[model samples]
Target: MLTKAAFALLLTLTPFFALAEQAIQSQHSCFKGPFETYQGWVMRMASTLKKFDQEVFSAYFPESKFQQVQQTLDCVDFVYQVDGFNVEGYYLKPKLAVDKKLPVVMFNRGGNGRGGYVTFTRKLTFQAELAAQGFIVIGSQYRGASKHIDNNGFDEFGGADVNDVVALMDIIKQIPDVDSENIAMMGWSRGSMQSYLAVKRLPNIKTLIAVAGVSDVHQGMAERPVMEKVYKKRIPDYENNKQQELDKRSVAKWAHELPANMPILLLHGDKDERVNVAHSTRLAGILESLEHPHKLVIYPGDNHGLTKHRQEMISEVVGWLNTYLH
Candidate 1:
C-alpha cells in the first residue's frame, strides 16, 4: 500500500498541485516548475517524440508515422524506495472506471546510470502506448539512476537494483485498478537482464517479452569489450567475484530455474551492435533443449532499438501479451 508520503507525492502531480513547486523538487519535473498534469505530459511527449521521429528516426519510423498518443491515458510519476533508497517510477493507465482493473506490464528499460534512465518522456510515449492497449504500465528508473531526482542510491546493474523492479510490485498491488495477478514483463537491452533477475524473484509474472535484451553478460563482455568497463563500474565487487556476479545476471546460466510454465518471447535485431543477437539465439537453443515454451524473433538489419521494426515489434508484443496475459 502507498504510504502517506507516497500518496501525498502522487497528489503533487495532480491538476490541483500543478502550480505548487513546493510539493516536489520542482526542477525534477516536466514543465517550468515540476511534474505537469497528464494532459501536459502527453502534449510534451507528443512534441518530443515528433522531433525524435523527424530528425532522429524519420528513415526508420517511415513516412512516417509518429503516433501521437491520445490524451485518454493517465500518466504520472512518483518516487519509491528500494532498500530505503529513493527510486523514481513511472505509472500509466487508461482513464477507465475505477472498478475496472487491468493487467499490468512492468516495462524494464535499457541503458544504465544517467544515460538510459527511464524518463517522464518515455512514460508518456512508450509506456503510455502499452497502457493505451488496456494494460496498466509501470517501470523504475532503478535506484541511483535518474535524469531528475538526486541521490537515488546506486544502480548495481542487476544487483540490489533488482529490488527497484520488485519494489514497483508493492506499489502496483496498492493501486485499485491494477490486476496484480495478471502481469507481464517486457525488457530492452540491459533491461532484459534486469527482467530475468526480476522474474526469478517474481515467479508469479505470467509471461515476458524481451526486446534486444541481454541473456548472457559473459557473452556480452566478450562480444563488446566496453561492457567490461560498465561491469567494473556498475557491478559491485566485480574483481573479487566476477564469475559469480556475471552468472547472476546471465539467464542462460540458470534458465531452468525459472517457473517452467512462464512462456517467454525474445525479440532482437540481428544487426544490433550494442548487445549481440547471439545472446538471444544461444538462449533460444538452451530453452529449446529444456523444452521451455519460448519464441524468438530476429529482425534483419535492424539497429539495437529495432528502429526499423518498431511497428512490427508493437504488433508482436501486443499479440503476445494478449494471448498469455489474458
Candidate 2:
C-alpha cells in the first residue's frame, strides 16, 4: 500500500536506525579533542564501537591518587595518523619550564592487546612523575591496543609496531617546544623489546633505559606461553617460521646493530617472575662483547617494573636520562 517515494524513504532510514541502535549498544563516543586533562575512553575518531575489537581486560587504577597527581601536571590526549590508521597517545609537559627546547622521553608501554594500552591513570602518573621533571613525555597505545578505536589491527609484537613509536618521534619533532635533538627512550617489560627494535632503527635516540624487558623472543615465548599464543595468532607465518620471526623481535641476537655511541641503562629486578632477570643479564653480556656503552643494574628483592623499589627506580631512570640525554 506504500507509495514508491515512501518505500524509498523507509529503505534510506533503515541503515541509520540500525546504526543508531548499534551506537547506543556499544556506547561509542566520537570524542576528538584538544583536551585540558587526562580522560580514559576518549574516542579517537568518528567510528562505531563495532569497528574495534573489544578487549576483556580492564586496568585497575587508584582514581583518587591519580586525580591528585594529575592536578599538578598538564596533559593532553592527541591523535596522529600512521600508515593510514589513527593512533591515540598522550603528551605531557611540566607545569614549569626553564628551557625553550625541553628534552623528550618516548615512554614505551609493556604488554600486548588491552593489557599494555596506556590507561587514564597511567597517563596521569606519567605526567606527574616523568613530565613533572621538565621533560616532554610521549606514549602511544600502538596497534591492537584497546584504548584507540582504530588500532593498527593485530599485535605485531616488535614488527610494524615499532613504526608506531617511530611515528611518535616524528610527531614529537613537529612540536616546537620539544628538544628533538636530545631524545631518550624508556621501556618496561614488553615495551623494552619495542625499544630495542626502535633504537636500532632511530639514530636520533641519545640514550636508552630498558626496565625488565624481554631481550630474547625465544626465551620469552618459552617463559610466557600466553604470549606465544598471542604471537601465533597475529603473525602470518608464525607456525612454520617461528625462529625467524622470533629473531626479528629479540635484541640479544642483534646487539651489534645498535648505535655504538648510544648509551643504554638496563634495569632489572632479581625477583621478576614475568620476565626473568637473565634477559637483561644476557643482553648486557652481548653489549659488553660488542663494546657497546651500557650499564646493567639488577635490583635485589624486586619484581617486574621494580614495584618494590619504585622510588629508587624512578630516581635512577631520571638520573640516567639527565646524565646521557640532557
Q: Using lDDT, give the best candidate's number.
A: 1
Q: Which stretches of candidate 1 lie over 4 Å from their true place?
A: 1-70, 98-100, 147-150
Best by TM-score: 1
Cα deviation of 94 in candidate 2 (Å)? 1.1
How far residue 89's Cα lies from its native spot in candidate 2, in Å, is 1.2
Please give, for residues 219-301, the per-residue lDDT of candidate 2 as tens digits. Answer: 98788787788788766688999889899888888888988899999999999999999999999999988889999999999
lDDT of 2: 0.73
Question: Which pairs of residues have clashing backbones in candidate 1?
Answer: 144-152
